[model samples]
Target: MELMNGVFRPYADSFVIFFIDDILVYSRTEGDHVRHLRIVLQRFREEKLYIKFSKCEFWLNSVAFLGHVVSNEGIRVDPAKIVAVRGWMRPISPTKILSSMGLVGYYRRFVQSLSTIAAPLTRLTRQGVDFRESDGMIAFIEARLSLVKQIRSEAGFVCPRRAS
Candidate 1:
């Protein structure tokens, strides 16, 4: 959090976006990109932060961030993630259902009314509720499947522009 506020805050909604340990630096042109990259690297150097080069993405038009593909155009669920979601089988237990729900829940930004659709499954996971694969199970399947399609076709990660 200190790194986020102290090092990246100035560049936060503009040239760089850092979520946890993943840092994505973007610019409209190669020259601007180089400058932005230099600035970030210099800061890290100043702070004595170590970076394993193997894990870094230097120059790319788009890259996967937290299971979502992000670019200047917008953000969308990574195709790889969507494939995993599509292959999910009907969960037979509360734990299974919760796991499935948790995965899809991460990409809820891609789907409208996802919380409402997921309410059924959420209920089944609550304490004292018998984990029954009845109404909630149906809703879960439908919600899971629908999220795959929506993310694949229509979803875009919209970065909010903070008022400067």
Candidate 2:
């Protein structure tokens, strides 16, 4: 990825982003997009790097990158991520709490006051803190549910209630 970054250093964050081998070239207008694409393709050629034609996507209004969907409407957590969070088990220990936090942290930008909402779990992760099953478990469930609700609302997905 360093090599890729070096190749596109001039364009980084102006109209391009590099994540490992994936390069996203973005522009506001069709003409600008074509010009940006040409520059990126030229850099790839200069660096002797090849992109798989099958993986290349161009002129998309929105695209999924690094688990979030980017569009004119703005970035949002992917629905698949919401589903995964929905299925997350209640944290029983500090380790579990940390792991859950790691996953939720990835989408922290989409949810408001995420750090405040996750304070209960965060407290349990501190040294010398004992994990209280009942209080912490309730907080975990509430936090997870809050995240799902917020993400769903932002993504404009109406989830049907599951039958008991």
Local distance difference test scores for all models: 0.79, 0.80
Cα lDDT for residue 96, candidate 1: 87
Per lDDT, the best of the predicted structures is 2
Residue 162, model 1: lDDT of 35
Cα TM-score per model: 0.79, 0.86
Top candidate (TM-score) = 2
lDDT of 2 at 155: 37
- Give, for candidate 2, the lowest lDDT window spanning 10 residues: 155-164
lDDT of 2: 0.80
What is candidate 1's TM-score against the reference?
A: 0.79
Give the per-residue lDDT digits (tens) of candidate 2, residues 1-164.
88887898989988898898888887767898899999999988988989899999888988888887776555667778989999997666689888888988877767778989899889888788756657777888899899899877853523222222
Residue pairs that clash (backbone atoms under 3 angstroms), model 2: none
